[model samples]
Target: MAALQTRALSKSYGSRLAVDRLDLEVERAELFGFLGPNGAGKTTTIRMALGLIAPTNGSVEILGLDVRRHRSEVLPRVGALVESPALYGYLSGRDNLRVIGSQLGRVSEKRIDEVLEIVGLKGRDRDRVRTYSMGMKQRLGLGIALLNNPELLILDEPANGLDPAGIVEMRDLLRNLAAEGKTVFISSHVLSEVQQICTRVAIINHGRLVRLAPVAELLQDGGEFEVKVDQPDELVAALKRQQWGGEARSEDGLVITAAPDGRGRSLIKFLVDNGFTPDAVSARHRDLEEIFLTLTEDPVK
Candidate 1:
């Protein structure tokens, strides 16, 4: 069963559609990335997924149970850290967890300790939340979500306010969670981090999905290759002659063009066959940020 799924899920505030038939499925144990620009209805979708707000149309399923119909049973199996965790500043970190734990029912002292350690707030759990840094507070919030040891985690901007080290730690922690067979769905503007951690990604713009693909597949920009050749200009001229290589160009002392049959070996053979020995040949990769901008900038139909 899919850990989380949305079938034509949509939400609107009167005439304005915030989310439009957004369909997505995150398989069990998958590390999934949900990406969008500001005002793209990501939060609205999340709210509906958590059953905080009902969808205007369609439905959401968590672990194969309809969220609207089985909210009680579905919510317990899911842990979420939304836009910002509501935390009492005056309370110590451990006390904060203790308080939320009470509402979660039967959370043990050992489990609390484990959550603190997992979120990297072990020794500092005694510190007041008011005195903690933004990153520390974020960790504490994540700790609260983890108190129940949920099977699915849905997080929004989890690395918000985190320092470089904190970001790396969070990345490692999330990877470890997925490795241990937990499903993690993350919504964030941090494209670089998402590229590294998420296996599959879904991008939405104008409340509609524009792309859904594996990170590797999304980064592969039409099988183009970057070749460091001695005669870049000559190579470009020769490549542009072929029907498959009409888009060939010389950029930054490199011959940039699509490979013959989208294979590196074929491109290498072509180069050698055409008397243009390449110093190096590598498949060109587009940055996730670049791809994100390209997809979201154009309004989805």
Candidate 2:
């Protein structure tokens, strides 16, 4: 069974629809990414999935159990950190974990040690949370989420406030979790990190899913090629004259234009045939950030 699935899930406030009829399925042990612009209802959808709010329509299931109908059975198997994590400033990190662990039933000290080590807080686990940096606090929040050893983890901007080193660590940690047969669903604005970590991504816009595909598929070539020619302006002007290269433009001395039939060889043949001898030519792969902006710029019809 899928670790997480939604069928026509939707929500609204008065007459304003926050989430449209959305359908999604995240396989077990998959590292899935959820992306959207501000006010796109990402958080609202998450809240409904976690049973924190009632959906205006449809249903959400966690591990084959309806979240709203089986809250007691489903919540224990899931861990989540949405937006800012609430923490006690006066308490040490270890004590905070201990307190939450107690509520989850009998949790051992060895398990606490493991959680501390996993979050890179072994030595500093006893430090007061108030004295920790923003990154440290974020790590502590993650540690708390892992205390129960959940089968599914849903994190919202988990890398918030992390430094470069911390970001790398978070990436590795999440990958390891998925390797260990845990389903990880993440929602964040960090497109680069999402591109690196998630195998598949679903992008929502105007409370509707606009795109869903593998990360590699989404980052594939969009028929654009970069040509490092001597006279970039002249080359750009010439390329624009062609019906196939009207979108051509010069950036950083490189003439970028669409290739006929979306092939690099076709572009090279055209350039050579037109006497615009190219110094270098290569296909340009669109990144997740660029694709994201293009998808979210307008509402889906």
Identify the leading candidate in terms of TM-score.
1
Q: List the residue pairs that clash in candidate 1.
A: none
Per-residue error at 53 for model 1, in Å?
1.5
lDDT of 2 at 154: 92
- Score candidate 1 by lDDT: 0.93
List, residue by residue over 263-288, the lDDT tens digit for candidate 2: 88999999999898999998777899
TM-score of 2: 0.92
Candidate 1: which stretches are off by over 4 Å? Answer: 299-301
Q: Give the per-residue lDDT of model 1 (tens digit) for 1-301.
A: 9999999999989999999999999999999999999999899999999999999999999999999999989898888999987799999999999998898788999999999999999999998999998899999989988889999999999999999999999999999999999999999999999999999999998899899999999999678999998888888999999989999998889889998888999999998898988889998999999999988985444
Q: Residue 44, candidate 2: how far off, in angstroms? A: 0.9
